[model samples]
Target: MILPIVAYGHPILRTIAKDIAPDYPELNQLIADMWETMYYSNGVGLAAPQINRDIRIFVVDSKQIFENMEPGEKNEYPGDEGIREVFINAHIKTLNGDDWPYNEGCLSIPKIREDVYRPEEVTLEYVDENFESKVATFTGITARVILHEYDHIEGKLFIDHIKPLKRKLLKSKLDDISKGKVKVDYRMMFAK
Candidate 1:
């Protein structure tokens, strides 16, 4: 049940997603497919919009990043091991701490990685897979992953946080993605 990820320049990626109720059709199945698709694509997260569904839903499994780290490598972000969870109707309650630049990439925009500055910590109010509400704070790599997927629900992309000059230089590459010229291992649905 791996769904095709929507490619860059897709209108759905630009459109703000809508919130869904617990009664939304096939909720469990959809979330399951998302997880499958994410793992298949080697992504830490996948937003509903990325799958051509304009809804406030996304999944994250930062644990993979930590689990796959080199033997001698150390965790840069203190107290951040990793997490596997689902976010529904997520809303940022606060974004705190200093901004740090991290190399970021998206499943929608393959072969394009850029450094984007983002807050070190974020407090969010969201519902879990069961539709149970919860409020939590995240930091380090987990925070970055959450914020990145959050952007998808907000009709924004990581590239939007980069410098204009840098983004300009990537214009051709971006265009190639839109027209289905870029190559990716995972399945993707292009705008063109």
Candidate 2:
């Protein structure tokens, strides 16, 4: 099932998500549904909160980002090719390297894209879908997607990272999204 994504300004999006236990009911089904929802929305990443679930779970298949890149741009995002993973109960152990600005968008905030500065690499400790713990490092585009989705679980959005002036300019657009005035193909739940 592809759940309706909750739009910006929805209270659930602002609430910090909780870590789920191994016995969380229907965990496998929920992950599968999330993947379906993400692909249907043409999104590289989706957090549990985005799907109206306040839990520490996110799915990413950043390979789509690499596949659509121009031949000359392929090398620009090294180490991100064919990266796919499920992050649960994730903790960012380290955020290292210089800050780079990446054009970011969210399924919740339709029709809005902004350049958000983020670390180039991230070290994370997280559990897989099966609740098996693992520690890993990611860089380039893969890191960018991970960091973006991680923010959802932390009650933060990509727009929150932009300059105050830019964010101020987007206030009306953000309000439109909250009131369900934005156009989006996939289903979305709005605050209004």
Check candidate 2 and list the clashing pairs.
none
All candidates: TM-score: 0.98, 0.98
Residue-by-residue lDDT tens digits, candidate 1, 1-192: 999999999999998999999999999999999999999999999999999999999999999998998755534778788899999999999999999999999999999999999999999999998999999999999999999999999999999999999999999999999999988888999886
CA lDDT of each prediction against the hidden true structure: 0.95, 0.93
Candidate 1 CA-lDDT value: 0.95
What is the C-alpha lDDT profile of model 2 across 126-179, one tens digit per residue?
Answer: 999878899999999899999999999999999999989999999999999999
Where model 2 places Cα greater than 4 Å from the true spot, the runs are none
What's the number of clashes in each of the models? 0, 0
Candidate number achieving the greatest lDDT relative to the actual structure: 1
